[model samples]
Target: MPIFHKISLRPEVENYLKQSFMNEEVVSASSKQEAERRFEALLIHLAHPPSFTTVRVNTHLASVEHVRGLLLNELEKQFSGSSVPVLQHPALPDVLLIPVTGPRRNIEKQQCEVIVGAQCGNAVLRGAHVYVPGIVSASKFMKAGDVISVYSDIKGKCKKGAKEFDGTKVFLGNGVSELSRKDIFNGIPDLKGIGIRMTEPIYLSPSFDNVLPSYLFLQNLPSAVVAHVLNPQPGEKILDLCAAPGGKTTHIAALMQDQGEVIALDKILNKVEKLKQNASLLGLHSIRAFCFDATKAVKLDMIDGTEGTPPFLPESFDRILLDAPCSGMGQRPNMACTWTLKEVTSYQPLQRKLLNVAVQLLKPGGVLVYSTCTVTLAENEEQVAWALKTFPCLQLQPQEPQIGGEGMVGAGLSPEQLKQLQRFDPSVVPLQDMDTDCLGDAKREDMIWLANKDCIGFFIAKFLKCKSTEEKVSRK
Candidate 1:
């Protein structure tokens, strides 16, 4: 019943991850075999998308029920009246969930193979239409209207425009080619738009492109949960470190009804621009996104802390979010990760730097939430351990809507502290728990009814700055 094959990492990468698991403070497996099995499960789950697509309705812009009705209509139309059951998340009043129909085993594969880059294929699994830029190569004689089997070039080794490929590829269902090989490579320097019209994707997820744009934002269920945990209020100042593409940034802005300051920062220029664009598309003007490395976001001088600008003095932000740059090992439908051990382990220092800056920039008694999309202990629970040890002023605060599994055991964090944390382990749960007919299965429904409980591989640790006057006086 597996929709995706168990993907294998390069041997060196595998060994490196094994050592990562076996690292002194990480998970203490009884044997190396146990570590390998857990890691292998991670890879298998990575090659498949999650069972549900989550959309956070902008309750500020539209009522949840109204948006839900619109979205359900749009989904039914998109899926050609398939009546794909759309459910409002029982706990998250502002969110809607659509089941991803998948591992669909009955579709016949066609002979004309269209090889696309791995990223594109992952998007396809999540219900995105195939764009031309991701197409590496199609059959030489392939033309528009030709039915073709779609495959993802998992290893990133496929040569573009090649007539044939013998390299490693995985079938990603089938579609009709919208462009000829000549049309894709012709005219402009870069390709654009719908290269293939997917008729039968093994996983049937509804695409959100241009659908209810302002009413809803497509976000990972966990990411949406993070915003609610932060629980921002109107007229509060919020800082989002490493906020790119503005998923949470815009959500925060919308949650506050556009009445507060939401400053978003990212290291890359293009990504920052994207954050701005998403904000604009959502009609959110409260977000001010900047392109800057967040580790250096704080300044010593009070005068440098001008409005709508960075280089702020200590305790300027009411709430801070460090959705730190991570190894991204948790992203699903990811067939391979080529990073070496050093590369995989490199984010620890960067995350610490960002966290240090975050604590400095947050107001006294303010909340700080640290999160990552990866499942590595170094990035998740261990980071929590490190943060608590390094900053005595910080204490782990219980997350609101504690929907995810408690923190993993190996980080030396106490039971109560681990209980306060949320880690969404995609590989730990089975996909069948989310099937349509299973909706009526009350026992099963009761188990996963909470919004925070079902989500991507994510980690969130909420911290409250201790209200010790001795610490405050010492700072001044």
Candidate 2:
């Protein structure tokens, strides 16, 4: 049962999305009515998280089986006797999938209510405990250890520190409060900790708060797929543009057996620090994070003596992963998006700028993978179409696993071209209820299929730069 309403979007933004679904290519393939239905389904699914929680094992430190065992034991303790199954991905060796059981309608609501911010509520749906900073309001007399029903202020109507909230709120099961109203609202410096311990969450997924921190990385399924598609090799020089938080950067290094040099760049200083921190945590010494703009990363003049950092010479990298910053429309478990159409459509230029840099920095025969966690044609397929025309030496390459659906239509890409790209469309795959009773090989197969299709909306396009004839002649 779909517990929440379709994700609330601005009127203009909704119309923009509607046109993308009802585009001529889509309408010709499937009727307008069917297109509308899928778009509606997408909205509903966005409000919910993926059917399974995906984790990427750090194969450099431990084997996938070893990490799976550790995760199984940890989840067993977390669930408290509820038998949870942890299955390894059939296609992806370094990935593990755990089914997320959900929208449990049986949990009774309580009289005393606690309201949390929208972002925190979304995290709760994905098995995150309510932290102190996310709490918005509590009952007047609510104290520590009080069992209260938790609700999300989806529309941002709940006043902070209010005694009661009657505005639009979605119930997110019940939890025992870990702090009183005074403790949360008190003018304290950095009150960072769990505010509510969810005893009966609506969605029963394991909370990975420091569980197997070194061996397992809590990543979305599509994200793990991106690193594999790049297929970084040991001893190769790779560049990761917009690689903040460094999930893919570390994964790429790990895949290379920590022998390659991965130069990761992000514009923000704090985000670069976070990238470095994640690299340190995962024990990936090959990754070097820098606070530099990827667009201006190319160096026209050579300095007498320079280190291996950005402002690199042209064609310096063997491979590049341009996971461009996007509008993030494809992220799941989102209850509401209050962005204007301008903000929603602002990523295309930036993505193109990054893509140009990626092409310039990649070696003639190197591979470049462009990806985005967005579902828009302008930022995804359209960009691919533009790239193919702008760069004559680049050719679309087939993805290795090809687990996701083909690229979306209406981008002027042919049938063969679309097949080369991968788009993880959540709407096309209906959300299935977890079959806990079935624990056989059949169940494992079903879980793997669901894990691939029912993931966050994502887009990936792989391109290989062909050596120019002039360059070949010069070499000869």
Candidate 3:
């Protein structure tokens, strides 16, 4: 049975998604009912959190086992002495996976209500306590230290500072109010503090609210997989296009052992600065961030090879990772998406423009990875199909530790071609508590290793530009 109820999409967007699922190829292989079923599964799964939370340990500073022990101890402490097992990922050496326990169905709702914004609600589902800033409203007479039931206004219809919300809402769990209604709404106008301490949540993952800051990085399983797939060498020129807040950028720098030049680019200056700050926090200095539009990264005047920076000539980077901005339909615990059909389908052109620039900037025999967090066929499989036809020189290269499932069926891709592509399908495996002791030491490790494959809805397609073809032929 699915953990989440039906996810809400705008009527037009729902129609668009239905059409995509019921397209020629999909309808040919499966009945329209089957296609609609899968599409509905996609929607429901998107609103529920993944089963496990992955944390990438700073292996350059400490060993994976050492970090794993520290994290396990930390989890036990966080959960009030409940010994939650932290297992090592067998395939990837630098990763540690912790199984998130629950959809904890038995958590009872209370009368004192505290409402939070959608994003905040999503965080709580993924194991985060409600912060003051994310609070949309609280019950009247809700004072500090009062026990309050927390709910997420998933549809974004809740007016802030309201005593109660009758609109669409989902109960996250119960928590003790840290701030009174007056403190949250009227305290000095802009006061910020912890709003609620969550005692029970639907999906019980460890809330790493300042738990292990410098040592552990709480990242989604698929996002962690991306950095490893890029396989950053110690000294190389790498480009992370559309890198904002620099999660992958920092991971890439860490993987490089802080020895290489990692050029991080995002259109927004503030976002680029955030990339720099994340690098600084992680003690990684190999990254050189730039606030430049990726589509304009190539320059004809720079063919002299001396025009180095911002608008560099073609073949400038050794490896290019385009984690393109997409429709973001894959994000978990998202109860509602108010986007129109056109708005949801508008990212393909932008992604293609970014891909064109990324391909041009990659050196021959260099690897270029195109990834998106969304599960849209147009953004993912369709993009790969388009890339192969448009760029003949760009041959699909098999991923190094292909942890995710094969790409979805459709887009005229062959079985072998689809196998080379990685897609983290949310519905492939259902979330269930694992019997950790059922497997021996080696098998337990292997099961957790495969757990990396079960992740958020994501897609990664790697390509290598062959030298046999010219730029013109490649673009043909």
List lDDT for all candidates, in order. Answer: 0.82, 0.90, 0.81
Query: Which residue pairs show collisions in model 3?
Result: none
lDDT of 2 by residue, 342-400 (tens): 99999999999998888888888999999999889899999999999999989999998
Superposed by TM-score, candidate 1 places the C-alpha of residue 97 at a distance from the truth, in angstroms, of: 0.5
Native-vs-model 3 lDDT? 0.81
TM-score of 1: 0.93
Q: Mind giving the per-residue lDDT tens digits that candidate 1 earns over 1-476?
A: 56667655777766765665566543443556665666666667777787778898887778998988888788778878766666777767887887776677878998788999988998998998899999998898889999999999988999988878999898889999998888986635666889999989888889888998888889888888888999999999999998998889998998899998999999899999988988887888899998988888988655644666876767888999899999888777677666777888899999999999998888878999999998888898989999999988899999988888888777789989999999887656555534456544535365445334335678899999875323545788
Name model 1 segments beyond 4 Å from true. 19-37, 304-306, 433-454, 467-476
Lowest lDDT block of 10, candidate 2: 434-443
- Per-residue CA lDDT of model 3 for 46-151, tens digit only, reads 8887767888886656778887888888887888997677777767777787777767677778889998998888889888888888999889899999888898
**All candidates: TM-score:** 0.93, 0.97, 0.93
List per-candidate RMSD values in Å. Answer: 2.6, 1.8, 3.0
Compared with the true structure, the alpha-carbon lDDT of candidate 1 equals: 0.82
Model 2: residue 87 alpha-carbon error in angstroms = 1.0
